[model samples]
Target: MPLSPKPDLSIIVPLLNEQTELPDLFQTLADQKDILFELLLCDGGSTDTTRQIAVELGGENSFTTQLLDTPPGRGRQMNAGAAVARADMLLFLHADSRFEAPDTLSIALQYLTSRQSVSTHPVAARFRLHFRRRTTHPSLAFYFYEAKACLSSEDCIRGDQGYMLSRSCFEDIGRFDDSLPFLEDLRLAKTIARQGSWLLLPVRITTSARRFETEGLLRRQIVNAVIVNAVAVGWNEFFRELPGLYRCHTETGKLLLFPLLDGIRILLASFTPDQRRTFWQATGRHVAANSWQIFFWLDARHAFHSSLPPESVRLQWTNRFNRYCAPFVCSSPVAWVASAAVRLWHRAMLLLCRRLEPVTKTS
Candidate 1:
């Protein structure tokens, strides 16, 4: 309708071997109201007839969809599609990820259009995601991503978070790091966050349950955590040691950011500084702080106001900021000012920190 004018957004999805889902995904797009955007599907060496299937879907819908040939990695596929996108915004979606509600795209576009650019955009934007099967387990992916985000800018956001970026912003910062075979999304998410604001709402995206079916819930969760830690510590290759049981997808359920991951760090920090010293010295050898987490992580999260953000999601993880933050409705006046001042000081120190850490590799 309306000749698909110039297209308001570009939705990029990296497909591996999913042929059956294309027809439904395309139909959903067709049914969407006034959603004029180009759907660029990147085929990552799909052995199946996924490419042919995508072509047929485009023909059936009478809309513009193109399949770009890319390497197997999701980051590479997204980068390839970004290189060709004509819209101002780029939404990198997973092949199995589906946004069922028509308002999903509409709200996303509105959010992006409203924001100018914050120095730190919180790394990634995700609406709640519901898994078809394990609809019960909340997504641990958010916690992992948020935990990673606090440690450093490069380690925060990963592809699993349903990526969205401004074309200009992406080009300015450069696309996802193709060098990253696994956490390219993680690295890019931080980069985007640093450049501007990362926004999220109460919306939901429904993804497939194939991962949960393959990996028993709890074991799969460990695999997910291990992989995240491996990537965080520059041991991405070692994650390869997992047996066939983990080689397949294992994640499911909608992701709830903000609290899941951040809350844990807060709880751990409850130990006093001396207590942390004693605890880590006694147990440090048992666990690895290879990357060495931030100093603030040791503080008892509840030490602050009741409304602080946990370590993950990074949404309002900072104890002081979340209280006085505009969205929280009511907060202590002293907290309002203190959090503001602390953040200001943090920004001032960022230059020195950036210099010491060489920008991306270290915390």
Candidate 2:
């Protein structure tokens, strides 16, 4: 089959040592139907056969596939891919992402283009995310997370959902932040939400949940919350001091949160009294902004039990909180109290994990 001279869309995927995941990813791309898309596989210094496999399998695929070597960072790799892509539309996807329907991209692109035509603001889209986990059993935590992914709330839209936007809009929003080794997607997500608007695409993108599973879902989520909190409060010391806070996908194991908590404790202690007060105040504001999650969790429970779609159920409590309570929670005193509560909760969780680790190993 001949490739289109100007493809309808450019699909950019950042790769590290993803040799194990490449075959399935390629197969899914190959299976994409009714879409004239070019595939740019940006390899970020994979020390494995990832590049070789991409070359071998890319040749077998019908689309225009190009492999480029880049520095070992997702943001750098994705930006490199976008710089050379021929299409007006760009879709950034994680290597572990899979599409259930062959026409997922086709429909997503169509929807995005349609929205762009009518809307004055720049439009970008992300698919609903589903975790392809190893287990078959129902988990309320996973369900809550999955439901949360469907919302357009701040910090809720993530990279794992597959970002699709026109190249012009991407340029307007600027390139992904490559300063840190991670959180580039998150930074861009917030930028888009601020500068333009996001549309939740109707299709779902299933991504491997190996990291969460291997690291223990609860543990991984807590670590993620910590990282997000650091980012929210401009806690540069956390990232600067602990550059390896986030491990690579292949290097994941049962996560130990004690070291992370201790690091935070040390960082807090090192801060001057004024700096500590300011940091806690900032953290309080972030916490208050996200306090809706507690109410949303209740809504999610009702939706889960009722077998309703994630967006279908909107409980009155969430509305009341937003209108009546959200403003009060953002106050400095309230923020300080919230910060104290968070610290207490953190210490409690650390103790719980310490007690549970030995039993988990024995079992």
Backbone clashes per model, in order?
15, 0
**Model 2: lDDT of residue 104:** 90
* Candidate 2 CA-lDDT value: 0.87
* Candidate that would win on TM-score: 2
lDDT of 2 by residue, 63-111 (tens): 8899998988899999999999999999999999999999998999999
TM-score of each: 0.61, 0.94
Query: After superposition, which runs of candidate 2 have C-alpha atoms over 4 Å from their true positions?
Result: 1-4, 350-363
Predict model 1's lDDT versus the native.
0.57
lDDT of 1 by residue, 1-363 (tens): 454567888889888778877877787677666667899999878878889999888887755798899987777888899888888888888777777687787777666566545433433355545555545554444333333433333444445447766777778877888875556776776667677556553455656657645544544444465455445534433434322213323233322222222332343356578754443333222123221232233232332233333332333334343343333322344334443543354345444444543333210
Give the residue spans of candidate 1 off by over 4 A.
Answer: 1-4, 117-124, 134-158, 236-363
